[model samples]
Target: MKQRTKARSVALQVLYECDLTQHTPGQALEQRLAEEHLEPELAEFSRQIVFGVYPIVDKLDRYIAQHAPEWPLDQISVIDRNILRIALWEFAVAGCTPVKVAINEAIELAKTFGSDSTPRFVNGVLGSLANRLDEIRQQFQREKAQEEGLSPRTT
Candidate 1:
């Protein structure tokens, strides 16, 4: 697997565990890092994904729930949910990855970690959200600016 992809996998593992158990995300991430030999950059990327998505999980879920109305947030598999969170965070919140790359990476992760129909499910939901990617990103930006006590920049 590619290093960045491996990092995302690690993040998914941590998120999955934390979602199901009382294990703290920090502790889970620390344990996973110890178990795996990730390069510093990749490790940091994993940390970024975990922390980035962890705090805003409910917000991500709201978006996921909107797009995947057939599956309640609690009904979505932990692995699939975390994979979506990772991909959404990468492209939408962090704005560090392209939409296509994030969606493709998400599909890859789903194939590896999810059930038989997971890839298609993930693709469908993300593809639906892709139509409003810019709008979502802008809303998140506004929320962040409000939280940080800064005015959102006008384009």
Candidate 2:
């Protein structure tokens, strides 16, 4: 697997542990990475994602709730929820991974780790999110510009 893919896998496992056990991401990542032994950069990336997702989970869940209203956040499968969390982090916060890459990676991870319906469900939610990408991106850019004391981008 690619490095980021492997990192995402590690991050997902750690995130899953955090969800079930109420462990902090730092604790979960330390133990999990020791077992997994990924490369340093991959491990760091995985750690960043684990830490990134936990604090903002409430916000992420709100987005998930809005996008997938029929399936409440608590009702969603653990693997699927973590997958969405990671993808949403990349899409909205990380700002380096492309949106399509994030979505596709989530789908692949769901296929490997989730129930039979997981890939399709992930695809549906992410596809819906993708449709709003431009608007979301603009909003983020505007916020960033404001943070930097500059006007928001026009395009």
Q: Which stretches of candidate 1 lie over 4 Å from their true place?
A: 153-155
TM-score of each: 0.95, 0.86
Task: Give me the runs in candidate 2 sitting further than 4 Å from their true place.
Answer: 137-155
Which candidate comes out best when scored by lDDT?
Answer: 1
Candidate lDDT values, in order:
0.93, 0.86
Candidate 1, poorest ten consecutive residues by summed lDDT: 126-135
* Residue-level lDDT tens digits of model 2 in 19-128: 89978888889998999899898898998898888887886777788899999888998889999989988987777688889999998899889999999999999888
Model 1 CA lDDT for position 27: 100
| Candidate 1 Cα lDDT to native | 0.93
Give lDDT: candidate 1, residue 67: 96
RMSD of 1: 1.2
Candidate 1: tens digits of C-alpha lDDT, residues 78-147: 8999999999889999988999999999999999999999999999999988888989999999999999
